[model samples]
Target: MKATATMVLFPELQSENDTIASQLLLLPQNITKNPCENDRTCNKDSVNINVVWLDSTSHSHFYRSMPKTVQILRDIKESGSLNVFSYNLMQSLKGGTYVNTVAFTSGKIFSRSYLQSKKRGIGNLFNLFQNGGYHVSMIDDLCWTWSAANCACGIPTFMGVKTQSWISEVVLGKRVTIPELWGNFSKELKLRGLNDIGASLANCEIMKANGITDPFFTGKSKVAICYNGLYQTDYLMSSLELLQSQLNRANRPHFSYLDINLGHESTGRRIQTLDVSLAKFMSFLGRQNNTLTFMFGDHGNKYGTFVQKSKESKIEMAHPVLFVLASNDVATKLGRDWMRALDINQNRLVNILDLRQTVLSLAPNVDVESFPINAKYDNHPNGLFHPISRKRSCDSMGIAPEAGKCICYQGRVLQRVSNQTGVVVLANFALGELNNKIQEQFLAANGNESSGFGNCRYLIGSWITNVQQTVSQNITITEMDIHIPAGTGAPQSEDVFSVTIQVGSNIPALSTNIKLVHHERISTYAVYDDCRDVGVDGDLCVCSATPTLQSWHIDPPTIFGYISTVINLTRYLYIYERRTPHGLNLETSCDSADKTFEVVMRITSKVNVGYSKKYPLTFKVKHGTIFFIDVFYQLNPKLNWDVKYDVDFKQL
Candidate 1:
């Protein structure tokens, strides 16, 4: 028998108020006859569904033109219906468009690449259903792939669907096979496979095969029959109508899940046709007097420019839309404490685990009293039914500051507040004692080379750059661009910096491969300013040296914007001041004739942000700005040095 879930679909576009008011008339009102009074097919608490996630709809994408959806909101406001609240969802840093390292993992010291590979052990979120004898089914959609088929591995597969490894079975500790009996699933059962079949007719067949009370549905199929219908308008609309007709017949609690794609592609807009159709479905379900519903948005704007604008903007994208609706009996059966908490938290910080716990509480067979008080992934141990503290910190919730978003009032965002860390900027010479430390690290890395420390000496040079600062107690983090400078005021976009080394007819862009990462040993309290070409008469030209400067203390830099990973050291070479005959011939242009008597190699690396003992240093920073320095070195194998490049930089 085809499955007819108690949960119904009300998928709509993002909020578009005007469109909602006009387009709602287009929604179908299928429940014209009242079965409640005559057929005895419905009652006051037949279904206890706590979730109804409409494919890709989030608050940011909620369309105003959907009449049915808008009407439901209006009805809730007018009737003071079962308790509903606003929830905040966390975001992966850098939004859904760019695949960065901070998307899934949440520790401080981590690379997103290596961390994602270790999340394969999936767990059972449906053990309660197995004990309660309730059937769980899913329509073909993207969510089955992300939330189930792949078991939250962050969709790393090429098809953006199942990892084809039976991951759900592994996690749930039970079978989660598809309805297809044998062989590979036909392309017909996948997304866009609807062809011309009505969703209702298809579901009726499943109902015949699997009786309402059948244990494990015989084959333990996961009801993953309908594939990727979210992309098609008619298919989704038809599916909604068909599902509603059956739900109107539903007399027991069951689970149905589906996902829809709006084709936003991160453009920050929604389809008008979808809004009305979903609203209609939602409106129909809103009229039901025997059901409970939970509605929410997944991670927002998986692809878009709005995702990277600012921290607040990132939070906006991560923040999802959430709502809960129940009939009078269902609401009352939920008990007194849950009702009180729901009434108090109209707008509160929420995580998905809380919702999962609530679903478990509704199951009849599962021992709710034995349910674990805390979940590994929850913001708190208790579910939404319990009163979660309004003052929970993101850190305790295991949310990485970079990948987390929480609710806050004006002047309340903790990132804007200072951490009470003090940093004092000092002259380049202030760290002269560090020269020994630098030599130790350089020798350790290259000492094994044929001509290593004997020819290559450590260059202890530094330059001061600009840091975005606000006089107000709060610090507004700004973007750290990837521009590098060869000399003072001469910023270049080229990341692969190289100085040509004239070797026969070959003029390769060979500059010593030197990468600067943040050094934990170097304190942010002291920073050296970049040197400039100041004429020391015709006999000698002097580069601008460090002056006694006041150090400005600031707060930690958030990754959304501030990240000064690379600094300019071109001026430290003192080549900008030396005439044709005075210093090493250095050309800023890549096309210039090759003439390098010293170091030559290419350097490539990303800017380092967090500083801890776990990772190696690639650059040094002060007051939240990375320093750049240039020091000349000889390419000769001989240990004797003709030009003390390290000393020259030290003198500057």
Candidate 2:
């Protein structure tokens, strides 16, 4: 009963000898290539711009934690540093935790697939500058993965390797077995005319007697930034002093980016005392000509001294420092109206991507201000590097509140509701009507929880305070015992903790309705054998590595036993006491992801435990991309190139 079109009746669809001419006529009108000819500022000739970018890692909220970083910033403010700008609460393009993602891709659509394509090129700046005839070189104490074949470097090797490492270190208590160098970049640079001036470790010695090892000059077209101090220096002060010295050496009328890895990532955990040294550098640079400077923190110290404070205080850990200064000449170049516009945006928000947009404006060929704000996306064309409205929300800037670490409360404060919506404790009489004393303790206990807190989940230090309202009413008391982990010796090893609470209606209660209520919060951490490398730049403890307790809340911290079982009990024992990992950790809150894991765990263990197993189980289909691993792993070119999908969840 099938019909076939084997006859010549469909001859109109056939190709003719002049098909080339016909094909050109069928081209789509909307798509075009490099369509910037119409802009008055779009000049096809070579650009005239110079830049010195100093890329630092970590040290968020430096202004609050390190007065020295601020003093230097203040000095820059008095100098040619730009205005205080923000990435508008944006996280790194690769991931939320920031360390693993591309350290510098802003305003670009990011996803695993998108990243695979962009991975060949480390950053947009490199390409933009190189095309504009600039020689770019990075001088740092750390080796940057810019323009290489690895994640840290821009190389297009399999991400599975890093994904495995990311999972093993964070989710499971496994060693960092991923290979740091997978495959060599096909060429020295992904694009022609770029250079990896290999200046790291002690190679800064190369730049000692003379300048960079190679001639870092070519027709005055050069963009280079260097980091002097290091987190590994005997004293952080020594490094800061070194950094101050380096800042004094930038005697050019170019845009310079400086990143001091002080207040280093969680690993250094070192107290930063940089005010005096930074002040000297800033003061000196403030008097320079046609210079622009910026001072900011990458992120708060991951496991710094103040990480365990209240939610408000912990927020500072997420909010990094940001200050900008610029010279008079540079101000005039940006235009006087741009300067006046800054007045209207006194307290606007910012993020890293916005920084990207601002930097893009520096390229004279791409005239960003020629167009209005993106009508569809709501982003300002000029970005924060110029002027942004004070009322700009994270949405307008394309930075989500959670990802950008935005702390604006926006009037969402907590208060008591009516008794019908509050109140109640059972008559078990164990805790006696859940009086004000216990409620006050939990409220003031920095929430004493994180995930499922609204439903009264208990985590040791997460700060949960929303349920105090219902505590005032007569409520029934409920009780539950915490399961303690077991192992004991001169070094005790057991994960056990206990908790009791009252349960009732109208109050947040961790009742049995939840999907999976169990112990163990899976956390990802950049642990290292040399505890010193804990929070170093690149977040890769791949060098001297060890398995660390992934939990940030653990005071002394937990790490795996380096020795074999029972060989050296004390050696393997956790330095800190155990808090039953029984509460809801943020990573485990993905209900669907949890279900997937639980099923996988069941199927694997079922056979070993003599239980009937459904090797191929039927699961409900969600209205989104449901990937089968085989499709991605086999390197199906057609699928890999075209089958990518993005899932956007809408909040109720």
lDDT agreement with native, every candidate: 0.34, 0.31
TM-score of each: 0.48, 0.46
Top model number, TM-score? 1
Each candidate's number of clashing pairs is: 51, 53
Residue-wise lDDT of candidate 1 within 228-331, one digit each (tens)?
A: 23323445455654554554554434444443434223344443445655666566555665566776655454323343233343344456556776666667
Point out the worst 10-residue segment of candidate 1 by lDDT.
Answer: 496-505
Quote the lDDT for 603 in model 2. 27
CA shift of 601, model 1, Å: 18
The parts of candidate 1 lying over 4 Å away from their true place are: 1-46, 54-58, 63-68, 80-84, 88-122, 140-234, 247-250, 308-312, 368-382, 402-405, 409-652
Candidate 2 local accuracy as lDDT? 0.31
Model 2 — which ten-residue stretch has the worst lDDT? Answer: 1-10
